[model samples]
Target: MLNIRCPYCEEDRPEIEFRNAGEAHIARPDEPDRVDDRQWADFLYTRDNPKGWHAERWRHVHGCGRFFNAVRHSVDDRILLTYKAGEPKPDIERMLREREA
Candidate 1:
């Protein structure tokens, strides 16, 4: 069974205790009224489906019930790390280099 570490809980738990919340770091428009319909639609619906390392939001639904972010490998389904929400996004390039060393 796949285990996910909940940054908020500070422990690894079974994957079933968590839920993928979708792509991370998505920011809302500062002026929603100024954006056209197409822009609004794009913000609501558009997401990247990259084949490699991807940053994503996840929730520890059955544990802390809090949300966090994780860097995961989309192809191999490996979660490299998890961090609390509102933190700055980690440098993926540096992390991958360190991992390969």
Candidate 2:
């Protein structure tokens, strides 16, 4: 059982409390119509599939009913960072300010 932190709920929840969404931060082309077939294919099919740390989008289903971001170490499934949805990632220095503010 993995331990997950839900930024919206502000609670340390179990992995069961959330659902694993696909790769986070997928950016679409600025001009969809201008994109060629090859470009579109690459964009749809290619993924980083990193071996080290990775950031993913997770949906907190059992908690605050919101989505958040998590930076986790892929090798051992160690969570490195978590932050609110659509907001910038949390920094140790600024995260404290976020908590205080």
Candidate 3:
């Protein structure tokens, strides 16, 4: 059972209370009507499905009902950290470096 902390609620809840929304920080095009078909399709369908560390969006569906970001390891199914929506993505490389010091 994965214990996930909701950034908004500030409570560690069971994984069943949350839902993985998808990748985080995908910016929408400035002009939707002007976007080419290929570009538009890429934006909608493409994702960086990394096998290792990944930054993703999650919603505390049963709790706060707010969306947040989480850094997780795909292979291990471990969530490293969770942050509020609209917050800048964490600097993972820098964090790892700091952890080693």
**How many residue pairs clash in each candidate at the backbone level?**
0, 0, 0
Clashing pairs in 1: none
Assess candidate 3 and give its lDDT: 0.93
Candidate 2 regions off by >4 Å? 89-101
- What are the C-alpha RMSDs, in order, of all predicted structures? 0.9, 4.9, 0.9
Q: Estimate each model's TM-score.
A: 0.95, 0.78, 0.94
How would you encode candidate 3's per-residue C-alpha lDDT over 7-37 as one tens digit per residue?
Answer: 9999899999999999999988999999999
Superposition TM-score, candidate 2 onto the true structure: 0.78
What TM-score, to 2 decimals, does candidate 1 have?
0.95
Q: Which window of 10 residues has the lowest lDDT sum in candidate 1?
A: 1-10
Tens-place lDDT per residue, model 2, 27-47, is 789998999999998788777
- Tell me the tens digit of each residue's lDDT in model 1 across 1-101: 67899988889899999999999999999999999999999899999999999999999988889999999999999989999999999999998899899
